[model samples]
Every structure is written in C-alpha cells, then in structure tokens.
Target: MSDLITVEIPLGERSYNVVIGPEALMTVSPLVAEMMQRGRAIIVTDEIVAQHHLAGVKTLLTAQGLTVETITMPPGETSKSFAGLEGVVSRLLDLNVDRNETIIALGGGVIGDLAGFAAAVTKRGVNFIQIPTTLLSQVDSSVGGKTGINTGHGKNFVGAFHQPRMVVADLGLLTTLPDRELLSGYAEIVKAALIDDARLFDSLEKIGVQVFDSRALSQAIAAAVAFKARIVAEDEQERGRRALLNLGHTFGHAFEAEAPKDVIRHGEAVAAGMALAFEYSVQLGVCPAEDAARVIAHLDDIGLPSEAGKLAHTQWDARRLVARMRDDKKNQDGRITLILARGIGNAYIETNVDEEDLVAFLETKLK
Candidate 1:
C-alpha cells in the first residue's frame, strides 16, 4: 500500500477520519476494528459493485477475525428510496445485526446513502463506515454525515444526519470507473474548490480531467475532504456554515427532478446547476459575468453538462423546473435559498429569491 492521506473530521464524540490514498481498501479492516471492539460487520453494496469489490471486502474483514454478512441491492439513484431503505433495514434485522456491529457501506453514493440511513434508523442507530467506490462518493458524499433517501417530491427529502465511523476512499478503485462517473465526481471536487479554495480551482482548471492522475487525484481528494470536514465540524446539521456546500445543489436538484432521468446524473446536473448559479448571480448583479464564464468554460471543457440548452437527449421545460425548486428543502417560508457566487471562490446564501425572476432566468437558459 502507498502512503495514505488521512483527513480527520472533528466532531467531538461524532468525529471520524477520512482515509484517502491508492489501495486504501486494504486498510478498512484494521481501521474499523480499531474503532469498534467486538461485533460482526454487515457489508451493504450494490449488485454491480458486488461483482467487483464485495469479495475483497469480505476477505479483508474475515481475515481480521470479524464475522461478515453481505447485502446486495440494485445500483442507481432509485435505490435511495424509502423501499430500498426499508429493505436494507429489514435485511439487517433478519441477520440479527446487533447494535454494536457496524454496517459497512461499500459502494457509491446510492449504497452509502441507503445503508447509512438504514444504520441511522436501525436499533435507533448503529455503527457505520463508508467505503465509497466512485469519485463522487469518495470526495463528498462519504465524508459528510448527511444520509437520506430521495422522495417523489424531491432529492434527499427524507434523511438523517448520521455520521460514519470512518470513510475509506481508495483512489486506485477509480481506475475502473467509467469516464462519465469519473466526471460526475469531478463536478463535486470542483464544487469544493469553488466554495472556498481559489488556489485549488486554479489547479483543477490547469490540470483539466487529468486531475484523475494518481498524484492529482490524491491531492484533490484530500483537499475536498479537508474542506468538507471543516464545514461539517462547524455545522454538522447544516444550520449555518455547512449550507455553503450546497452551492449548486438547489438548481442542480431542480435539473435532476425535471430533466430526463437518463439524460443527467447528479454530478452532471450539478455541473449545469453550478453554471446556472453563476449565470443567475451575474443576472442578479452580484457575480461578474467573466467569472461565471470561466467556471462554465472549465466545466464544458471536461465534457460535463454545463449548459441547459446543450443537455442532450432531454426536453427542457423551465416552468416545471421552477416548480421543482419550490419543493426543494432549501426553501423557507415560501421563499427559496440559493448559494450564489460573488465571484470565483466566493459563494453566499441568497434567500427569498423571487420565483418569477427564477422562471425568467430558466426561460433564458432553455432558450
């Protein structure tokens, strides 16, 4: 195993470490064992991941002299649903999983969110660890304690703030990722930089997609994890500082809800959402148009969905998207809260935004 980079999330009793590096999967057993004394582990993963990584995880845990059980679910955003959540919890119950045992979430964001929520609700909460496989999950979703299942009304509408025991992100696992999935995660990495790290954004812009190269990938993961850890430590429940992490999420979730499901994944919608956010900022006279253009250009250069009009295989309806935003969790008192940028590396929460103004902007974007 190569030297690993560890970012500690300090939350007092709830704090944990995010271990990032190549071949970090090998460290999971020892890490979990250290944090948890004597208990069985239930590995929850998606079917696609099961074919590739399940045996490896089971072998590692078994070698550590820990009993292990595996639960496999179908992969995709759909798995983060109430049905899926119930199924996982029920399976753990059938397995006679004890409160002391840990639930090992061993897949992408979907599996992690599903299993994490299951752990949160089972026996009123059980130990959970994240072994995020995709870049999106590794850098962002895995580190934060925000876990939930999506609802028919909107994304992550029903969930809990369940922190993990630890996060094991093996950058080497990314070598097998499809380019689209890799780019999806890249959007999140860019998101972390755009929120507060101008230098990191500059580095990402310079490297382009080569940020996936071993050294760059490790650095990017460490930086993203560090940024998230700080915010999560300060505002674990997103009452304040942590809301900044949702920079593109409001518009992004709207895009995901309204766009053709297959046409856009979470990261792609977020890439487009970030662009819309900057453009909206420019329209609101808060962010410079040049700054918005720079952000969009970098995203477009990487083949991500940065423009609403350019979204392929999808129909656009600005009114429908506007409606979705109304259902977003970020809204308060019939007013929406958006994370808009003043410029590169500067974003703030803009509340009580007029729906008419948003509708007008969406119309322009669709045009």
Candidate 2:
C-alpha cells in the first residue's frame, strides 16, 4: 500500500483521501476498487503523457485485475476547455462508463481538471483518481478537488469541487519532466513557502535537490501536499482558509492572460504572478519591501520568473483574459479576491483594489 495522507475534506459524504508514495499507481485496484460501485474504469490523459505513461498505468491496473480504457487530449493548458472536456465525456459515454465507474486522470493539471470535470458532471457524479505525473499537479492542482474547463471568457470558468478518490504521485514521473517544467512546478512550492511556510522555503532554498534524489523529491512532495491537505480540509469549499492556496494565482492568472497562450505555461505565469503580487503587496504596504525582494530573489534562484512582468500583446484579448479571473472558482462577489503576501509566511486577502489600480498593474506588468 502507498503511504497515504488522508484529508478529511469537510464536504461530508464527498470527503476523500490524497495518497502519496512510491509505486502508488499500482495500488489503484484496491484504492479505487473499494470506492467503485461499478467495475468499469476509464483513464483520461493528454496525448503526450498517454504516449509516455498511459501504458504503465494501464498495465498496472490490468495486472491488478481491474478493467481499463484510456482516452487522451493534446498537451497544453488550452486543453482545459469545453471542447476538450466534451471529447473525454463523449468517449466516456461511448465506453459505457457509468456513475459508479471511476475516472483516473493520468497527466498534468490540464488533464486532471478536464477529467475531474467530466467525473463531476457525469450522471451527476463519479469517482475520480488523480494520477498526477508532473510536479505541479502532484503538489498543487491535484489535491484540491477543484475541477473545471476554460472558456473564451477566461481560464477554468466552468468546473466543480469534485474530490478524487485517491492521488498517486510517482517520483519517477518527475524524473522525466523537462528542466523548465521542473522549475515551473517549483514555483508553486515557492508560493506556498512565501505565504505560510517560511521554514519550507528556507529548506528548499538551502537544500533543494534535483529529482535525482528520490528521497528528496518524496519529502518535497509529501511536505507540500500535507500543507495543502491541511488548508483544503479547513476550508474545502474555498469559504476561508483554502483561499490561502491562491497566494500568487491572481497575478499569475493575469500574466497568463497576456501570454500568447501556451507560449508560457501555467507555472511560468505563477512564477511571474508571485513576483507581481509581492510587488503589489509592498506597494500597498501590506508587506514589507524587503520581504517582497526576498520573494523575487527566491523565485529567481529557482530559475522561475521574478520580474516576468507581463507581455504587452496590444491585441491581447485582455477583457477575455480578465473575464476568467472574475469567474475563476477563487473569486468572490464582483471583485476578484487575491491572496497577497505581507511577508514570507504571511498572506491575506486584498479586495480593496480598484479598476484604476488594476489597469495600472496590468499595463505596467503585462504591457
């Protein structure tokens, strides 16, 4: 059995555990088998991961004596879309997957969100397991149960809070991530460290090891996932504590809005977003200037963007991009709430930003 970290998400009957460990993918049979009221299961992955890892996952499940089917979307953030999700769901129905069946999302965050959304809406609900193959999904997106697809209006505009039955993070997968992709995932851990875990940040800064060390990678994954599990369990519905998880997301999403879609990945935007939020925090007096500099310095140290600023694609569909932030599952009221850092290990919501400030922020950073 994989070493499991159970998160008692307060969604009552919808609660689930997030398992972390070596060879966790093989445990799918018993882990999911116990959760299913039906015998059929479907694996949804992006074509890239499908070509690389789908066979391993499929073989593992089959060896466990579980029946499996696999479907894939192309690689990239854009795949988190209505059309992409429709393809998966359509395939699910065609495969005769039922409400009691399970969906095993075996890729990065994009596939997790798309497949989880399919599970959430399929016959009202279905079990979903997160087999996050990338470092970012292992520690961030895969744990929260927030699933959705992007709209032309913005990113992740359509989705649900459907928790997965289990999450498997294979350190072996991290070994295959590109150097840039690895750094991208590190940005999220950096954001977590800046917000509420200075000790973790300090450790990563002082002793962060490359993926070659299985022990180090496992420790990093466990630590980050444990932190997220605690936050999600406290506020599974994003009513409070969970919002802390968005520390760099606001600025990150905006940076994403200005990008040439896929030219920069989600983690890259998050890296830039962390810097922007830290800058905004210092400017607003919410955080100290020294702290802001430290935040930027750390991201830079990890090869993430500290001053990625923003791209000024004059024709950039700003309104279309900004629209996503407003509707993002993280927003509240008409004002999009942001998790801004006050200092390392301290972050809070700032809803006082006005349109003028936003425009200036966007123009200065994005343009």
Q: Mind giving the per-residue lDDT tens digits that candidate 2 earns over 1-367?
A: 5353333334467666665656666654566665555655678888889878877777777666677777878898767888887888889889877777777898998889999999999778888888899888988999889999988777777789888877777766666788888877877777777778989887887874463366666677777777787788788878887888887787677667766756776787787777878887777777889888877777766677676543222244335445556765566678877778778888887765665565566566545
Look at candidate 2 and tell me the lDDT of residue 251. Answer: 63
Error of 1 at 115 (Å): 0.5
Off by over 4 Å in 1: 35-39
Misplaced by over 4 Å in model 2 are 1-13, 27-29, 33-38, 209-212, 309-333, 358-367
What shift in Å separates residue 273 of candidate 2 from its native position after superposition? 1.0
Give lDDT per model, in order.
0.86, 0.75
Positional deviation of residue 70's Cα in model 1 after best superposition, in angstroms: 0.6
> Candidate 1, residues 1-367: lDDT per residue as tens digits?
4578989999998788888898787865676765544556788999999988888778877887777788999988888899999899999999877787788899999898899999999999998999999999998898889899988777788999999988999887777789999999999999998889889999888998788788889889899999999889888899887889998888888777776676777888888889999999999999989989999999988889888765653577888888888787767788888999999899888886998989998898887
Best by lDDT: 1
Work out how many backbone clashes candidate 1 has.
0
